[model samples]
Target: MTTVLYFGLFAMSFDFISGYTGYLSFGHAAFYGTGAYTVILVANGLVPLFPTSTPFMISLLVGGVFAVVLAVVIGLVSFRLSGVYFAMITLGFAQVLYIFVRGWDYVAANPRDGPSVGGTHPAGFEIGIPGVDQLNLAIGVLAGEEATVLGHTLGSTAVSYYMVGLVALGCYFAMQRILHSPFGRVMLAIRENEERAVAIGYNTYLYKLGAFAISGFFGAIAGGLFAGFRRSATPESSFYFLTTGDALLASIIGGFGTLAGPLYGHLFDETVREFLSKSGQGGGLLPYLRAGLGDQALATPIFGDMTLGVLIDTLLNGHASLYVGIVFVLFVLYVPDGLLGTVRTRVGGTLADAARDRFRDDHSTPERTEGDDE
Candidate 1:
């Protein structure tokens, strides 16, 4: 799903800074919200830089730049404080922005409701290269304007999915490459032991700042994509501290330190939530379970005013948050290294040992045959 990919990118950004530098940022959503608002403002011609609708690509870059600017300011101030102190400061800044947005109607379309790009375009949210309508992506399946593709009437959403997905994939690979470089090695070194790094002449603070900035840049880009996908930017979705919290949750579940882990974790998280949300619908998990359980078993009350079926149904309806929290707690207690990390530690070692044994068997000099020994 495009939405999942967009959020995956955001989670990866969170992991980039926090996982590597051990700096937990509680205001990462500030950058995300900023980028979304920047893209929407620029695209809607509200910004003076573009008298007309800005091209989608340019808008995304501008959004990222704005986020990076915010990151620098936040990092400079927050990095002065380490650990929890730094996190709280970042959170304080984000809350300030959230409160300002919620109360300011002159800038926002509505203080409580937030600003939207409007539903004038039938195709959910779309972005086009300047003067080239054909080169555009609309980010919904059948919700957008119909376009002919290979004799099929496919909406802009299908095309947009591919476009956005490709961008996300490219961003992931780029971050991976960065993490494998010499700079990445320093980042790891800093994470492993900041004091030792400093003692060895490495400037840990600068590296942390750099990591934070890079994280902000990627986060903003993801936000821009989300704006384009949803065709609107909402303060509640953008500036809410929960957004950052969700990213943190994903990174922890996915595996910290590994660049790809958060991406996979987010995808898994989104998929589970989607299923849970859909379970109550006609074609969802609830319907199938209800059918299998039959009317009698379902209606049998397990407790006063609550049937066994009702409890299960209630959980299937809107209990994703509860489930996620439970999973997080269990992970923290049992699998501290996280899903990917645990797998790497367990399965990876087994495969590695097997390979080593095979290598030894192949490379070891064979005992001389009886005749050759003679």
Candidate 2:
């Protein structure tokens, strides 16, 4: 599912920097929105001027590049702050971005439209380019264009699903390899203890900034996939703390600092939310008991959802921060190591012990040199 893939990528990207480096960037969504906006901005010309230039692909790359640059900038600004200060500054910056995007009337009025095939000669006319006269994408302005490919109608929502799925899987494996690399080990050291890492001659700032930039770069790629595939990138989706929150929720719920935890987390959150929303379609006791009874059940809308989003969107759905708060509380209260961390501690410790014992036994062999050694 795109839902699973999207949030899986979300978790990995967030954890790649935040969980690994211990920076805990709250404004991480800025990079993601930046990617979406970047791609959309880059490909606007290609669709109209050079229709066969593959704007979609260019948009993805541009989005990723923009994410990397923004991450660098974000790293520079917030690298000085740590813990609460880092979180505060990150949150502040995210709000600033959200407000700016929301206030911009041009993008708001028009929003960003997707890359469309524009034509010169109208009425089902096929035109060829000057130099490359052979290749012509003569698409008719006929009915049901969206459902067909080259005059063949095919039910192809599955294509989008598979594409996103592969992208997410690629990112996941790549991240896993990176996490196991020497650089990733250094990042873990920095996360475990920045002072000790610095004392040991590690450039904490560089590593942190590098991790942040790389994480954000991938986050933007994911965002671009989401935006381009969806064909509609809105301000709400692009610039928001909650976007980051959703990723955080996925990370936390599915077990942060693990290989595929966020993927599971997305499934959990999306399934529960979707189920609750679709099932809660009636004016319940709270609404009917009140004076106003027009089949409207909630006081306000939350992230375009009814019920719970309306009830506590302010304190709770500020993204998934509210829900994650409860989860964090539970995690701290009971499982301090997180789900995967807990499992690794139990299993990895035993494996290490066994390996150590084997090594000791291998070296401790009563050497046949008992008579030769002095």
Candidate 3:
């Protein structure tokens, strides 16, 4: 779930620009990597002038600023083109960064493996109000704080979950607010028809650039949060093009153009992955089947030396990607608008509006008398 929160935020940031502007940022992971590396580097005191004592919140903000700058640099050139060309260019930039980071010794002793939080910073990253010890709460699986309230004790993992959730929720609302603004409407306009938007005297390029920068800022924050919680960042995990691909997959599964849809989509993805995990981390199918079925049934051969358990293990134990891919294809073919988008369409507006209308109809319905039927 913590993975869903931070990665969901990254997906939402991707949707903010790609879904709204119809310009896919195939290399959006560049900003994500930058933010992750920045947080880890700052914590290790390798970043110039920024000491290891720098507050976690400050490091996140600094990373966000860095992402914004990187976005501007990338967008300046990429936005000059449109469609697949733009995507390829952005992807090229990200790939270049990935390779550089993979080989850059300045980043770590073994840059290929990336960096981890060392002796310079041993505590969990704080996530509340900066400079206020009481207001702040540390977040990490093992390094977080634990508290008891009303005889119920919250463990470190639970504390990290709530803190990370709070930040992700805040970022979601901020993006939602932006989506409802005039600037966001312009973004929609550009997506609908760039030529028409240009004809209307709007500098579509600048709007796209601004949107890209904003998205990058949020994307970086998400990366920083991820690094904060894990206490590590890696090139393959953070800078790889597949990182952006994951966000793209979430946006498509959740609902492109619907700001909050990607979170649900990513949650679904994670749920499926965990369920089919080889190690059965979270009560996966393999463990359940093994526990439920006896050894006799499992050992019974259905084919040439392939028993029931062996078949299940071979086909389903760690093949979540196959199932997820099938689901994605079904969604594209039958539910093109995605889960939330289809619901919104059926409701004729947002979920809140639908609920309000239902309430009004229920209250305004005329009362029936005994003779009314006659």
TM-score of each predicted structure versus truth? 0.84, 0.68, 0.93
- Please give, for residues 282-359, the per-residue lDDT of candidate 1 as tens digits: 255666777799999999998899997988777676777677778789878898877777777875643456679879
Q: 2 or 3: which has the higher lDDT?
A: 3
User: Per-residue CA lDDT of candidate 3, range 224-295, in tens?
Assistant: 988888887888889999999999889888999888888988998899888888877889988888889989
- Residue-pair clashes per candidate: 2, 1, 0
Better structure of 1 and 2 per TM-score: 1
Sorted by TM-score, highest first, which candidate order results? 3, 1, 2
* Candidate 2 lDDT by residue in tens digits, 1-374: 65567657867798887777777888888877876665554444422343334444455666677778877877798888899899779878878987886666544324354222122222111212333434222222231112345887543354455556766788788888888899999999988888999998999899888888888878887777666555546667867898888788777766666757667767766654543342322432332333353335445444555554356334323234344456557866787655655665776743446689779988996757666766
Model 3 ranges with Cα > 4 A deviation: 109-123, 364-374
The segments of candidate 1 whose C-alpha lies over 4 angstroms from its true place after superposition are: 110-135, 140-155, 278-284, 301-308, 314-317, 347-374
Q: What is the lDDT of residue 58 in candidate 3?
A: 90
lDDT of 1 at 342: 79
Sort the candidates on lDDT, descending order: 3, 1, 2
Q: How many angstroms is residue 118 displaced in model 2 relative to the true structure, after the best TM-score fit? A: 15
Residue 150 displacement (Å), model 1: 6.6
